[model samples]
Target chain A: MALKGWKELEPGVVILEPGNTIEYKSGTWRTFRPVIDMEKCIHCMICWIYCPDSCIMVKDSKLVGFDYEHCKGCGICAHECPKEAITMIEEAKAKAEEAK
Target chain B: MVEAMVKKPIVKALEGDKAVTEAIRQINPDVMAAYPVTPQTEIVMEFAELVAEGLVDTEYIRVESEHAAMSSCIGAASAGARAMTATCGPGLALMWETLWVTSGLRCPIVMAVVNRSLSAPLNILTDQTDMMGSRDSGWVQIYAENHQEVYDNFIQAVRIAEHPDVMLPIMCGHAGFVLGHTLGRVEVLPDEVVRKFVGEYKPLYSILDIEHPKTIGAYDHWDYFFEHRRQLFEAINNVLRVIPEIAQEYGKISGRYYGLVESYRLDDAEVAILIIGSGAGACREAVDAMRQKGVKAGMLKVRCFRPFPADEIVKALKGKKAVAAMDRCECFGGEGGPLFIEACSAFFNRGLPMKMIDYFYGLGGRDTVPSEFCDIFRELFQIAETDKIKPPLVRYLAVRE
Candidate 1:
């Protein structure tokens, strides 16, 4: 019984359903973003499997790109890249570079 | 569900823990997760026997830790089960976090607490320390004065906890060893009567319900935290109204009456001693002794501790010349004890003019006999007669210190 406000929800209302974290937009908490160099990429999909937020996108056994929408930018993907294909850049700098 | 019904009660000589086990057997809850702890082990032990005998269909999970015990109950309770557990002392301390989780979620789980002293010097004796420590965890707390009351409290707890207006979990406590090990005459009601009385488990919200899935224990942030907490207060506030109604129903079945507070010989008394749990037994004798000595002394036993019967207390001790609030647990470095602080504050808030003092007694299973209570009542009588409370208003009774 959810009482008035979040009292019934209790303090720090735990997310109930699975995959609801996608709606949380954790990327907003990010100060840095992982940028991948496709030419240097080995397509080993290690980053795809190791991203804590599951932000690394893969289609048909191939690494496509980072889904920055939900990435908190902890740099696990950059840290996990065996081929040195990924680089961590300031989110604002990446945005400016993209804008350029 | 209605087929397995027995129509008459069987009176039996049983200890406090056995009485709790009998009540659990009658109620036949959906889930019970417990870990063994001293003074509380017999309760889980007997219940486990029932489970082994296949006498009840309860899912008895013998968990590894008290934390897991309460955690499993929380999981089952969230899944719309009538979940329960039992423990005492450090076990209760271990389950502290999950106690908040269960009560904060408004799960109607019932716990049978065999009250024992907390450990520092490693004592395993009867006292109110353990349960008193968890007073703020948002659960309804009831103290039984005897073995029969222990059984009655546990039976009634299911109703109180499940009452829609008051879905807070309940902890029904009795003194460890003192009551937990002592045998007493307990008249248990017919299985059908108890089953019908406790009724079926109704789920307001269930994690297991697929069609109407809902979130429980959701991560509540500061934005709405106050309102959520206020909801708990709203439910507990409803308990004052709900408890009596449930007790009245219980009375209809058992031919007994109960209330939040039991006022004994207080009507015409000039001085009274207020206490909780089994200590009232001695306080009553002290009251009798005071009466023989022409001192108008009485006793008020607070059966329900949480959603504390503040109004009942204020009304019971209002016109008295003096009162002594006795606490079984100590609140070190604080003003008096927990019960004393509450009683003092309650009287002060209600504008009741009475010379009041508090005493710490029966700590770590140390005995507080009728003589100690007589001493307390005598002091209260002195204060009432002279309108002067002794300088050290808060003192330890019978302590070497």
Candidate 2:
């Protein structure tokens, strides 16, 4: 998105539009990404409860995957997981592996 | 601008604080939140009595402190209510942080600041230090020379602050004891006339409107902080044009006129004195006395200080041999006082080669007599005649040696 000039901004920068925070991608600040192993996963939904950014995806009351777009990858879900189904990986290593 | 006067003013002798309270009674704002402080105490006290009498349907909130007073005003104003508050000296200091917040949120809250000195020995009297300290807090500042001007300034302040081009807070400042405690004849307009004059306050955006909800006081970081502040700068500058137009409209109803700066005998004069607030009265007297002695003396009273009125001030002082900027507050460790610094910049910007000096007086409620001002004019004349500026450009006036 293009930045606004001073003339284009509103007086006092009052946000006229609600829910504008979604425009900012917090995922850009991530240093580590969380990966889940489905073979070792239990449907206890501990990761869903522990994910601070609500990045844990759920479907039909079942654990699915992670929402990477908004996740900051704090590793809270991996730390709180009871079944040891999730692991934290460095984002640089993950991107390098993907590039291969 | 000519409209037939349909209503006659009510002539009454009232104290300055009472005169302002009467104006507030006529304005009848939607909400008032204030905590008491001397000189300014009478305004809130009398207005509270009016609220008890049910003369105005305003929600008067007796807050715990000046900080809360300004905070409550911000909330009320954000919710689309006409809000007002008053304070002085330490009270103004306590609300210093919130003052920026009020202006940052663009709340058109009108406040009557009875100018008083800040405490060291804890004195209660008249000075400009209080408001001068907050001069850069992004509020439109208007100084009054007497009781009537304070009354009139408050009425005009409502329109100026709420103007769509200029959605900013305004401070109508008068000297603490000089105008706030003194009795003077103030001609007040009819209540209906004032009501009609100020009209209805239509907020551009209200937080209370659920149908079109808007967020105020949101956080802005490096990406947009500069832009938001730039808008504030533009809005305050817009007041430079809006003030004269509103003052002209106000003059049509009341027989008195106002401007950004009032010039007394500046035309065709070689020497002049620039001042603000109630001190202008003594300066005017000194100017008149100097004229009797065949001296080319004049006075420039700056009613609007925030915008600084640089162009208008330069124009007024143009072709003059010498001028002095009299300030009631000390700048301390700086080159000179705030007004002096600003006047110097104005002259320097225009490349005007006029002899200028800085005078500090009336700090901590000290009396600045007409003779003191006459002494300043005498020194200015010598500067004009010699064309040789003296050392120690900034001098203390009316202080024990």
Output the number of the TM-score-best candidate.
2
Task: Please tell me how candidate 1 rates in CAPRI terms.
Answer: acceptable
lDDT, candidate 1, A1-100, per-residue tens? 2334444443323344556657655577689998889999989988987887788898888888888888889998889889999999999888888899
lDDT of 1 by residue, B1-401 (tens): 22222234568999999999999999999999999999999999999999999999999998999999999998998888999999999999999988888877888889999999887989899889899999999999999998889999999999999998888899999999999999999988888889999999886677887775566786655656677777888888889999899999888878778999999999998888999999899889888988898878899999999988899999988888888999899688988998989988887888777688989889998888898898888788788778898689898888774
Q: For model 1, what is the alpha-carbon lDDT of residue B265?
A: 96
Off by over 4 Å in 2: A30-100, B1-8
lDDT string, candidate 2, B210-328, tens digits: 98877899888799888888888999999999999999999988988999999999998889999998999988898899899998899999999988899999999998888999999
Fnat across every predicted model, in order: 0.42, 0.90
Clashing pairs in 1: A6-B228, A7-B228, A12-B219, A12-B220, A13-B218, A13-B219, A13-B220, A14-B217, A14-B218, A14-B219
Q: Which candidate is the best by DockQ?
A: 2
Worst 10 residues of 2 chain B by lDDT: B1-10
- Give the runs in model 1 whose Cα sits over 4 Å from its true position: A1-23, A38-50, A57-69, A79-85, A92-100, B1-9
Worst ten in a row by lDDT for model 1 chain B:
B1-10
Best by lDDT: 2
